[model samples]
Target chain A: MATRAPKTKRGTARRETLLRSAERVIGEKGFAAASIADITRDCGAALGTFYIYFTSKEDVFRELVGMMGSLTRRMMTEAVQDAPNRLEAERLGLRAFLAFVAERPSLYRIVEEARFVDPDAYRAYFTGFASAYATHLEKAVAKGDIRPGDAEVRAWALMGMAKSLGDRFVMAAEKPDLDRVTDEAFAMIRDGLAPGGAA
Target chain B: MATRAPKTKRGTARRETLLRSAERVIGEKGFAAASIADITRDCGAALGTFYIYFTSKEDVFRELVGMMGSLTRRMMTEAVQDAPNRLEAERLGLRAFLAFVAERPSLYRIVEEARFVDPDAYRAYFTGFASAYATHLEKAVAKGDIRPGDAEVRAWALMGMAKSLGDRFVMAAEKPDLDRVTDEAFAMIRDGLAPGGAA
Candidate 1:
């Protein structure tokens, strides 16, 4: 049993190391340019070891996409839950998204590139997040806190604004003021989707 | 002069053919993978002929970005002007954007990839369109037709929403009902930004 615990820990460590290597390669070279050789070399792992964990480069990319989606969703959900009201939830969601992009730009790049790598995977990843946000929007709409429409579409639009702004201004630019950008983006969302006329 | 006219016509024809070839090659092979040689070969042009018009592959890409930005902005401006009111202008802008993407999927792909190819070029290209839209939004805000705020930021959010939906759903998916999808997107924007809860 003691031996089994060490083996399992090593496997987990190996998986994480591979993921980090993949993120670095993808971020620098983009999804199309990133090759298995580059990833294996970065990880200082044999090709055989990489294959043992990931079926193929594409498989590794899909796993990366899934991992990023789950991590971002979890973080945003936790942040939203910590908020006191729907408005705060919305603001926190935007901030959490920016923080996620800032913290793991490589992971964020991989997730965005998944659109080109596999549109279905990209859709699946976004659909999960959209559904979660849609549920939140639906509740707010039910409470007459926000205008009613297609909550799913609204959620996507809201998320898209945050994602685009974060990618364009924060990730693409160096030395961006995160606090000001986040505040401006959050204010835009709040005013754009406020319960009634401009608050 | 009459003899020179045919030569000018041929030059224009060759340029158009080269642009079309670049679009196809870049669409299939991506910007980084699509070589000038591939583009020239596809266009049935000599190596020297390629440099006569463009200094480098990057030059062609820059021209393409400029062309697309101008085309999109022109279409959007026309649509907004054709609209009878501010609300209609918003709807028309959404429809115009969807229509442009639907008609030029390859161009859209090229423009999107430009973000990865050259950040400055990408910003310049998008900022052109953003500024144009912001002008329109500023007009509406000045007329007390829409809520007052930073028109530039509002324009970015609107464009971001349209782009995200276009890339995620319309262009990514085959045989998407563009009209319906566009209407759904516009509905959200209309509801979210409509003055005095008019939507």
Candidate 2:
């Protein structure tokens, strides 16, 4: 479904409000339990107002998943843009990822829920990220910034590590200590768990 | 809900049949959409027989999640039992996990569904695995079989890596090459992505 951008500033703000409210309601109550009425009510908007910007609850949920994808890519890119090498970039990228998860835990939950709610969207989100991630690793290899290996495999492995760490350290933690989690995890990422590695 | 084990040999066989059927049906249809009738139908059992073993659909689903946890731990333990070192165990454990996913893709989906269907069970599943895994890593560190690091961080990070790689290379692949995926990922796990490590 094509959810075109609103023309007017007020319409745009209202749409954003609906989207944020949907994120909260759907993320908290889940897609099945969450309703359009709940989403609209969360933002203090009339039930009819939800239809003006989106077609259905699925449409809005898909939009939220899409927003998560773009926001994550943007956040990661900006976080690692100025790193001197791929190794340092990995550190920065991971730290930024944990921070992002802490900041928008609901969005993370929403993206994961997409696996069941919208399988195609869920596949697209990870595949898109993995493809781009693999390409970056390829460039890093060509530049001699990292070891030579299967970029696709490396990308998936690293992504998994980051995702799991985010789940355990940020999402599950009552009081998250991102600094220590990142430090230890990033250390492993940089040097691995094998004996005789860097200090 | 206390679902006592059926005492008779025939009763035990029927319960197994129902659980296996539940795994296939619920895994395919998802927890919300799946019904006890569907599960019993898949196993060619009468509707009344389901209640003999299970209190409700939720009870059976929780049991499946619990089963996955124990089965996974047992499988990993057996897979890595003969490894000479912790690093080797990591490799063996990961390969076994992927193979397990391939063999029982439905069960894999069921455990993942637990994250949404039964949140406490989901936490228990991972937390249980991570705790055991961390202990193993601690032993390895003491023995100098692996580098010294935060065992908990290493455990979760490695688990995440294996999980993500399984999702992409095995779960998502049309014809999975478990050998190559295992090798590539295990290499990164052992030596890491740093430029000047093992060749």
Query: Please, what are the lDDT tens digits per residue for candidate 2 over residues A75-142?
Result: 99999999999999999999999999999988999998898889999999999999999999999999
Total residue pair clashes for candidate 2: 0
lDDT of 1 at B152: 62
Give the candidate number with the greatest DockQ: 2
Stretches > 4 Å off in candidate 1: A1-7, A35-52, A83-87, A173-179, A187-198, B1-7, B32-59, B83-87, B173-184, B190-199
lDDT against true structure, model 1: 0.75
Give the Cα-based TM-score of candidate 1 against the true structure. 0.82
Per model, kept true contacts as a fraction are 0.19, 0.87
Residue-level lDDT of model 1, residues A82-139, one tens digit each, is 7766777877777778888888989887777776676677889988888888898888
What tens digits encode model 1's per-residue C-alpha lDDT throughout B1-199?
0111124877878877888888888877778779999999997888778776677788788777777888887888888886876768888788788888888888888887777776677889888777777787788767767666666667777777888778756776678676776676676655552223555
Instruction: Give the CAPRI rating of model 2.
Output: high
TM-score of chain B of 2: 0.98
Encode model 2's per-residue lDDT on B1-199: one tens digit a residue.
Answer: 8776899999999999999999999889898889999999998999999999999999999999999999999999999999999999999999999999999888999888787889999999999999999999999999998888999999999989988988999889999999999999888888878889675
TM-score of chain A, all candidates: 0.89, 0.98
* Residue pair clashes in candidate 2: none
Give stretches of model 2 more than 4 Å off: none
